[model samples]
Target: MTGFAQLLDQLPLRFLLASAGCLAAGLGVWGATALLRRLPGVALQRSTWLLGQATVLACFLVILLPHSERLRLVPPIDVADMAPSRAAAPQGPTARPAVGGAPAAAVPGADPASWLTLVAQAWLLAYLLGFGHAVLRLLLARRMLDSLAATGSRLPCPGQPARAPVVIEVDAPISPMLFGLLKPRLLLPQHLRGFDAAQQQLIVEHELMHWRRRDLQWLSVGIVLQTLLWFNPFMRMLRSSLSWAQELGCDRDVLRSRSPAQRKAYAAALVAQLRLQHATPKTALAFGGVCASTLAARIALIREPSPAHPRRARVVRILAIAALACVFAASLAFQPALARRSAPTATQAPFSCTVMVDAASGEQLAREGHCDERVTPASTFNIPVALMGFDSGILKDARAPVLPFKTGYPSYNASWRADTDPSSWLQNSVLWYAQQVTTGLGAARFHEYVQRFDYGNRDVGGDPGKDNGTTQSWVGSSLRISPLEQVSFLRKVANRDLPLSAHAYDMTTRIMPKRTLANGWEVVGKTGTAPGLGRDGNDDATRQYGWYVGWAKKGQRTVVFARLVLDAKQESAMGGARAREAMLRQLTARLDVL
Candidate 1:
């Protein structure tokens, strides 16, 4: 859910970028149209159509493309994280701090992330509603056109029998208009039989030209794009302009070789048809995509067609194509905000890692976020300590050698105050018990075992000269492991590949916290959280890192996973528990059976 919320946060920015692209393309088309007014109408028409489609495509491209990571951070959002109670906001592995006093559980409207999420939801709902409404209009319009065509009588082609389209002479008081995309019907008037055969042929020829060029389909594309970018005013204007271009451009094609006398005759047909009204052409309708605004321009252009400037037209065409390429490239170039840190900052960016690997083959199955950046392993190291104890025979089994909590022992969690065996120790994350096991291993064997395990860096030397490697190396001192390394170690444990006694594998696996999924996959994992000096770690939080590592087994299949999250007290919550919940949610979403 949180991951989804982050994506939602980007919706507004995506729309803004797309809108800017539409504005650019619209301006370019306007300039191209003005320059080509003296040339063939087809040039302006085709350019408008092309640039409009490019704008539509840019809208989608912005959404599908990766966002700009170099965007500047929202400063005010990090201001509240300066409170001493929360330490400095997380810098290395940053997280959004639940609005200072707003509380993580019930984040208030004051928080930007919270409100941004709400805005995104509302925007999506509104967009879907608008799109659905547009679609319904198209469907109803198509139905009406079909009903009108049904009542009209079919007629054979006036002149070109072999190449003629299915002509329908409807009784409806409408002008001759081309209709339908897949099944284009050239609808003519029933009274056309009384007019001059040449006039009739001219009308049929005009609508036929639209059918041959598939202009209706292009108009439909424009309508859909207009719907998608309804919020962008420029898109609406571009669509209107493209509609004019479609009609005028078709005029240019139909009269391409006609002399002045023939062009005048065709212009007269358009002027006369302007008197009658037709059900505004909808989806699949041909020349009905034309408008009143273009009728006057069409007649004037047809009566005195421009002396074709082929050379000038070619130059404009090249420039228009170049502008289109620039628009699309600009859209793709913009990236989502959230850059990797290049230098120290007052706060950190959000950080998380979730990785899964095939236990047997050691092949990565799933990976997300930064998994290679190492951090403190914290209490997740308990799994290794448990194995070493069992292997050394110092720990016999899950229930043996029950040890009582000492008065001086660390017991931050109430559950750790009582006696703990291997099972309860893991269940409660009893830190003291792990220290006891390591202490019993006698420094030498402890280092030897960790080195044998090929664990992170294998430093285990504790902090500087503390001489406390066995007791606190994995605590917050020297032992650091990346999420990837954690997965590697876990794969061996799940596959029983480590050079440990049989009892070590069996006892450690038996004691770790286990959850059996519905598909009979037994998942066992451990959670860990650690605090450190905020200064040296380049993080603001004393409690900065969390880990959840484990493996899942079902019959012959086994998969190991490691998840890590970091925050500077983003909330009053245990990091390990948060990491566990998030990791499990991701696993549940991706895994079909296990």
Candidate 2:
């Protein structure tokens, strides 16, 4: 039971769901094509096939869009929440303590959950490696074609302009193929010179038809999609079907305005090229050399070609469009909604909130809990405080001088044992340091900046006469903000849109910690913790509230997020440390961190 649960937890349910959707789309496309084959003309078959492929691609895209609400369908499971048998849990160390203190608990043995996680990670790595290798192979094939084009001589045909695809006769054993995107060229095998002018024209016409239709560009798109979804066999099958459809479509176009004799000549040319044993580059579109089954289908379709009926073709077009619309709509509508969990138990902490937004577009990617619920900004207020301090010239620089630690202050954290600079103060969450900065800025100036930045509720003046009303209001007193607000503020800071001096903005960013993951992605942010309040408005010593606000950047993509974990029990809380851990776990699970 444990192993099975662990396996289920590690399963890539989302990707599996997408694969199933693609399979359904493929079946629909194949069914439409099967029906088209029974119709009178081959003209509608090409458009039908193209529309089916497009529909499948569109459906796959819809599946990839960010749907935070649907995330409930695969809510993450916290392994720590699971009850473990006493015997399976780690026991106290049997050996005597070393010089530091009592020996730590024995290291826990690997379990089913850990093994399952490792297996999942391995599979992901394999898929990435395969995708990279496939891309490299494509690049190599393009290089090979460039080399062939460079060495081969351009065969001049009368009436064909120089700008037109100059026919290049290469010393390769492969069949004639079309290569290049910007300056397309037709490359013919050396053996092709032995054929009569009529045979050569038939081969050239087919390759030229591919260029007119820009089949190379479409083929490139198909190749890229295949590489991305290499792990999905259905995607591979879809690529194959699309390619076959493309070849058939080109054949239909070539024979569209040709006589019966010309059609027979093109069919003979296709068979003659098939006898060659060489394989063409995957990146290029070849005239012949398709598989035996595809060759057979092409010949059969060519033998009895019928003229397209305008009215009947219009009807088929309408049906194809309708079918595509239905498939796309069903793909989105059928997405499984995430399962909502029941209320938390008494011992468990109340649900928290986390919202991740794209900094550039302000698009919400994923969210959990009630991100809009107002809560005290706690130490997170330090961000705006530092900004205001710099803008007002109250603080010159982040590293100018150090302030002596207030020895008389009562604090639970042991890290605040010595005087610290602005950076150190931010890192250690030294309340005294922030209080000093706020007091220096004073109430009027602070409130002005707060209102300007639209900080939280814009209520810097907390309940009067309270101990925390004046200077400490932004902490755990009265001033409040939500996860969504935090994200917005961070985005403004990142974009330098806030009303602050350039120096102040740079210093604020410099003081904040930036974490780099194994894959070279970076996360820059600050942490804040507030004291939880009881129903009577008194501080609740047993519970704490934590916040982690930051933006993660990889290449050109930047995601700003804010996480708030409330009502955490004392033993399980480390202020912002707890929030950071929770945020990182959720980010890893929801985002493609690897």
Q: Against the hidden reference, what TM-scores do the models get?
A: 0.56, 0.52
Question: Largest TM-score belongs to which candidate?
Answer: 1
Candidate 1 Cα outliers beyond 4 Å, as residue runs: 1-48, 67-104, 158-163, 191-194, 284-290, 309-311, 333-543, 546-594
Worst 10 residues of 2 by lDDT: 338-347
lDDT of 2 by residue, 522-567 (tens): 8887888766655334566666778899888888888899998765
lDDT of 2 at 204: 86
Q: lDDT (0-100) at residue 239 of candidate 2?
A: 61
